[model samples]
Structure formats: structure tokens, C-alpha cells
Target: MAEQSSPDWMALARRGRRHRMIFLGTITVFLTLVSLPVVMPYLWLLTMSVTTLGSAAVMQVFWRAAGLVAVLYLALIVLPPLMPERFRTWVPAMAAAAAVILTTLFILPLTTLNNFRFLWNPDVMAAQQGRSSTIGELPSIWSAMGNSFALAGTQTALILITATPAAYALSRLAFRGRETLSRGILLLHAFPVMALTVAIFIQSYWMGLLNSILGVVLVLTTLELPFAILILKTFFDAVPWDIEMSAVTDGASRWQAFRLVVLPQVSGGLIAVGTFTFLRGWEEYVYVTTLLIDNSHMVMSLYLFWVSQDAMGADPNLIAATGVIYLLPVVALYVFAQKYLTQISFGGIKG
Candidate 1:
């Protein structure tokens, strides 16, 4: 029998690349179609924020810009693999540049433009003032914003302080019922937050924590703890044991080793956990509304609710303005934490 020819490894590799490219293209198209319905409303919201240039004109402009962006985005996705081998290295940089430009032109403008009417247009301000008489005294926007920041900041700090040690132990220590305990913590997260409302209220009332920022912070911290611990634990698991062992050998106490050596390695996880905790606390509504009925302790979430009730006969633009303000801090935090957040891991072995 004739000897079989050796397989063409290069041809097989080329075929694999082609298959991957086709799969990625198909996925991109599918996602784009799925996202259109979700993204259109937000696009319209941004357009409405910017120009009284009328919906028809704004929409026409939006679609044209969107089409151009889609073309560029698709080119970035589809062109790289097809490019000559010598030029392929440039594709990623070009794609990143296009992404940044697209975001700068289309996405970033929305936040700034959301409050344009209130900021720049005198007539719109006058109209808003006229409607204010019909709407009862709205809560101080500044006060509510301050309250929100205070609550979220406090909750985030508490979570980081409490989660780090607990996560380290869970990840590294060999203890009885460790797996069971970890599962139990996660099970707590599955409970509907509303289900705990009555119990929390009673506890708060008895502990003299009712209707206070501290109370809200404590409640949110409790709600956030399980997930925070879980995330931090995964990050801890990713840390190499030998590094901490070396620190211990260098006359560092266990706590010192954890603090001086281990913590720095998992900084990304800490930031990721902190960002999620802060955003949750910032956006919390039901618990805040239930616990703090008065405007004195009202947060931005409650303030937005009050505005939406037509209590101030506020225009859609004004409500959108409040939303923009409310979202800014969260956006800023995410941007600051973006690098760390991307590096967070959940799949390292216990060390």
C-alpha cells in the first residue's frame, strides 16, 4: 500500500482561522441586530436631551451617524483578518482608535447634552419655573445627591474592609464546612431583597437605625456583602501562595503578609468589588424609600421617584437632567476602575 501523505498543518491552521473569522462575523451581526431595539430608545433619549431641533431632524441625523459608525465598527471587526500578514499588527490599534472616536462623538455627548436645556436655554428654565408652582416644593437636588454619595461611599468602604479578610480565609484556609459556608453565603443572595424588608425594618427600628443614612448604608452593606465576598474570594484564589509564603518567611505576620503582600496582588478584585457595591448602594431605591420616608434623608433614587410622580410637574428634560446628574458619579467610578475591573478573575486554585 502507498504511504499516506503527511497532513498539511499550515493549510489546517489557515482553515481554522477562516472558520473563526466566519463565526465571529456571524456573532457580531447577531448581536448588532439584538442590540438595536435596546439601543434605539437610549439614542432617542440622548437626541431629545440635546436639540429641540425636533425629533424628525434629530432621528435622521442619529441614523446617519449610527450607519457610519456601524460601517466603521464592522470594518474594524472584519478587515483585520483579511489584511496582509505584514499589516495585520496595525488592525488592533486602528480598531481601538475607531472605538474611542465613536464613543467620544456619539456616546459621551449624551451625558453633557442631557442637561443642556436647563443649563443654557433661558426659555426652558422659565417654563420649568412656571411649572414649579403647580408642583409642590421639590426636594433639594443637591441635598439628595450628597446623601447618595455619602451612603454609597460608606457602604463601599465597609464592604471592602469586611470582604477582604473573609474572602482570604475562605479561599486559602482549610476549615470544616468551608464549602458549605461558601454556598450558604451565595444562597443568601438568592433571596429577594424585598422579602427581607419587614425584618430589616423591625431590626432597624429597634436598633434606633431607622430613617438614617447609617441605616441605609448598613442595609445596603448587608445586601452587598455576600457577592462582594464571593468575588474577592475568587480573586484571592488567583493569588500565588508562594508569594505570601515568602512574605511570612521574611518575618511578616499572617495579617501583615495578607495586608502587605496579598492585598496588592488582588487590588483589581478589590476595585471591581468596590465599584459594584458602590453602584448598587447608589441606585438603591426600594429600601431607601421604605426606611426613609422624609426628604431630609432622601437619596437621589427617591428624589427621582418624587420628580417622576409629577409632584413638581417637572418636564421630561428636567427629569432627564436629574438622571444625568445621578449617573455621572457611577460612570466616573467605572471609568476609574475600568482597568482593574477587567483584570478581576474568578478561576484561580486555592492557595
Candidate 2:
């Protein structure tokens, strides 16, 4: 019997046309949803800054940040169309990095003209003109950044060590009540993380850890455990049981098989997990706010949160500038992990 297969280009093209319309509609909706988070805050910030100075005055900090990102995006968009395909990707990334360095180290300090200073210096006015709003403090922002990096580094190391064994057990070995344990862990998210931090605060106070790094690490470790387990377990499950059996057959111990083979297979997943934990720990506000009551223990999120709010009424500009700096390690971690994000697949059938 002869079997007819597939469709001709005309018929295929008709189907493709229908799907293309649906895809375009879906993309429009998805893009709108995705853009809201970025847009709403900036809108509020724009309104706040403009209204503060009355009449019309430029906000230097926002302009500089927007300008830098805009230039990078414009370069990336235009460079590919004009340059050779071979030079497309690497050239844009290198140029963007150089731009970022220059913006931070050189251009940023020059942009800090206060709105009140308009009458003071005619040259500062001529150089910046109506385009000058005082830039935020650089020194305090740098201190916040140093604190952010330190906390992120500490949290990454702790997450890798603890999450690996816990995830391995969940992935590899079935024990009584294992399902119940996993379910409980997932259900923990039902309690608002912020509420849990409040309870942790009370506990930390009683235990005399309220203003210490240990308190911060303990809170982060607990918060990150469930997510780490889920990610690592998925990666470990993708390893074939037959491979482990064969290793056993060749006199490789289970631990040896895991160390040499299994771990290597899932290193990318581990990195992703570590990066996730580090970012959460570094940027988390509720836990740090409740647990760390002193200047010495302040991480960037708490610091920025306070600074932004006027912290019982302080400096709003300091907060805004610090918040931008606060986002760096997280951005860096994502960029690094994205390079090694490979998909592994599994099937019951094995050769």
C-alpha cells in the first residue's frame, strides 16, 4: 500500500500563515505583560523626579542610566546589520563592556550637578545646561556595592555545599516519606517568605544572632533550599540508571560514579542553582531587614531599601544610585551561567 505524506508548499504556507497570526498575537500579549514590571516603576520615578524640581528640569541620574543602556542596545541592533556575521556577536559584547566601564568610572562623576546649584556655577550650567540634576553620592554607592559582592560570594559557597547532597538524595534514592518531604518543601512557599522572615527575626533575636552575618547566612540557606533541591533533582534525574549500574559493574563505587560522572553531567545545573541562591541571598530584603539591625551587617538590598525610603527620612538619590549598583553581581551571574545552559534528555529505553 502507498501512503501519502505531508502537504505541498501552498497548503503548508496557508497553515503557516494562520500560525503566524496566532504567534504574533501571542507575542504582543506576552511582551505587554513582560514590559509592565520595567515600565511601571520607571514611570513613577520619572513623575517623582520631574515634579520635585517644578517647572522643567532634567534628571541626570536617570538620563545617564537610560543613555548608557540605550547606546548599548542601539549599537547591538545596528552593528549586526552592517558588520560581517563572523564579527557580529563578540564585537557588540566587547564594545558594550567597554562602554559600561567608561560610564561607571568616568562619565558618572561628571553628571552629579544638584538642582539647587543652577545659580552657583555658569560653567557647570554651560557644560550641563538645563540638563543637570545633581547626581547621587558616589562614595556611599561604592560602599554598598562592595557589601553586595561580599554577601553574594559568601552565599554562593554555602548554597553549593548544602544543596548538592540534599538534591542528590532526592534525585537518586527513594526513601520512605520522601514524597511527603518533597511536598512539604514545595508547600512551604505557601507561607509568604516575608512572613517567615519576621518569625526568623524573633528567633534570631532570642538566639542572639540578630545583627550578625551568621543570621543572614542562616536565613538565606533556609530560603534557598527548596528551590535548589528542585533544580538539582531535575538535572540528576536526567542521568541514566544504566550508566550508574555499568559503573558499579566495573568496580566503581556509587560515590566514585557520582564524583567522576554524575556531577560532571549536571555541573551546569549546579551553577544555575548557585547563581539563583546567590542572587536571592544578596538581593533579599525582608530577611536582611529583620535579621540585621546594625550598619556593619547591612547588605545592599536592605541598605538600598532604607536609602530609597528616606530611612526615617534620609537621602532618596543615594538610594536610587545605590540600587543601580546593587544589581551588578546578579547581572554578571546570569550572564556567566547562560553560557553553559545545555539541555539533557532522558528516556526509559537504554542501549
Candidate 3:
């Protein structure tokens, strides 16, 4: 048999495969390295809490913590690029896994202690520390949770209803000045939220919506409108008009077509947009502070702020713990909707 040489095409194929593998390996290493610095301190926080100290001691510990973080960040930047290709991918992954373990085991619980104390009123906290036997559960936090849920839910629904149609028009319609209008919508966020609150409060006062949760809802809805429209509009633009047109040819009305065809494709986007709107309003304090005057109408954000400011029998535990609890809805919402959010963005791309 005659000796055969490698063909040009086979040689090129091998070269291409090697390039891709190397590229992937490099990317994996870089991402892993970037994540290490963030994860490492969280680990340290968790670990250090095992040994104890005073207030001043804690302050010193935090300063030392900062210095350590700076060093770790520098190490990630300088050392990762210089690492061997084989080690690059696995090193970061291993580091990240270690960081995660540290965070779960040590950091979260210690950090949580601060916020947890804030939820317990003085008598209750004193009771917890064995200073007294009498105690009470966090009634205020429970009330605020209900209030936050109601307000966030209402605002989220309105955003879906109003923002969806408006966004659809902006993305799909060819109306005059649509581009300028879209830009203008986003421009509203440029002004300080406080400035906008001032203006909205003036209107609220004149209209007798001041001191009302309804008023707070109105202000948040307006503030949220820009983001809702902008995000959904982009998603709508990604959907092909061909689907709608096909439905129209079969005698489907525009509304019917949108209901049956367009919406199915954008369900993920809808969830994402709704999640964004809910989270924004859920965490918002500015408008709630300005527009609400009635204590009865106070949502959770304002309720928490009151806890922070109230002078009578204040315990850090009461505030911090409740604040953490107050954060649960946003966390839960994120957890439930994260997959939907990704899908929606993907749908937006295809739309």
C-alpha cells in the first residue's frame, strides 16, 4: 500500500475543532475566576463568625475583611490569565463550589443574625436572650407582609394589562414618531425619582388621593409604565408579524389574533415583565413615603421604614429580622419566575 498524507480539509477540520475547544476552555476559566472574589468573602464571613467579638472588634474585622477582598480580587484578575489552559476551567469551578459551601455553611447564617434581631421587639428579644419569659411574635411584620402582597399584586396586574397592549403597538406598529416616543418613555427614568414624587404628590393632593394606598399605587404604576413598555415592546418586536397575518387571513380579528396567537409566544416575556414590575413596586419606598399619609394604608416598605425610625423601645433585631422576612416575597417571586423571565427574553428575540 502506498503511503497517504493528511488531506487539507481534514487538517482544517482538526484545526477548527482545537480552536473551539481552546476557546471554550479559556471562557470557562475566565468566568470561574471572576466569580471567585465574590464567593470568597461570603465564605470568610461565614467562617469567622464561629469565633466572637465586641462592636469595635466587629468593626475592625470588617475593615480587615475589606482588605482581604481587595487582595482576592487582585489575585483573580492577575493570576487567572496566567494559569495553564487545562487548569483554567477546573480551577474556577472548584473555587466557586468551595465558595458556595462556605456561604451556605457560614456567611448567610451570621449575616442573618443581624436582620433576625431586628424583627424581635425589646421584650421579645430580651425574652429570647433569657432576660424575660414574656414574648410576642412579629405581628407588625406579618401585617406588612400582607399589605406588600396586596399592593405588589395589584400593581403587577395593571402593568400586564396596560403595558402589554402599549408595548405591542410600540414594537409592531408603524405609527408616526414611534421611535421618538419610545425614547421619550425611557427618558422619564432620568429624573430623580424624588423629583417625580414631588410632582405626583402635588397632583395627588389636588385630587384628594394623598394619604391613600390607591395614590401610592397610581404613582408606582406610572413609574413602572416606562420599564414595562420598553421591555415588552422589545419582546413584541422579536415576534414575526407573519403569525398574526396568517390568523387574519383565516378571518381572525386583530384582537382575536393577538389573544390566540401572539400571546402564546410571549408568555415568558409577559412573566418576566410582570416579575420586573412587581419587584420594582414591591421594593419601592419613595412614592409610598411621599403619597401615603394614612398609617392604615402603609405598604410593607413604608412599614419597614417606620420600624427603622421609631424611637420607642427600638431593637435592631426587630427591624433586621422583619426586613429579611419582608424580602422573602421578592426572593420567592424571583425563584418562581426566573425560568419564565429567561424564556420571555428568548421569545422576545424570536418575536
What is the lDDT of every predicted structure here?
0.78, 0.64, 0.69
Best by TM-score: 1
Candidate 1, overall lDDT?
Answer: 0.78
Write one digit per residue (lDDT tens) for candidate 2, span 1-351: 789876698988989878876776576568657875896566335433323333232355445555665566546653455466788869777877879796787455544435223234434323432232332222233455566666667877887888788878887888998889878877874557766656788888899888887777877777777777766777777777788878888999999988987898778777777777777777777766667666665667765564444222333433333444565566677788865443322221121
**Candidate 2 global CA lDDT score:** 0.64
In the range 1-351, model 3's lDDT, one tens digit per residue, is 988976799889999978976886787679768886876555444333432333444444445545555444544554566567776667656666665675566444444354354345444533433432322232355556777787788998988999999988887779899989988998985656766666788899999998876777778888788888877887787778898999999999999999999988778789888898888878888777777666666678876665554342444445544555666777789999978776554235531
Each prediction's number of clashing residue pairs: 0, 5, 20
Winner on TM-score (2 vs 3): 2
**Residue 158 lDDT (model 1):** 96
Better of 1 and 3 by lDDT: 1
| Model 3 TM-score, all chains together | 0.66
Give the TM-score comparing model 2 with the true structure, all chains together. Answer: 0.67
Best-to-worst order by lDDT is 1, 3, 2
TM-score of each: 0.81, 0.67, 0.66
Q: How does candidate 1 fare on TM-score?
A: 0.81
| Candidate 2 clashes between residue pairs 3 or more apart in a chain or in different chains | 112-135, 113-134, 114-134, 310-313, 310-314
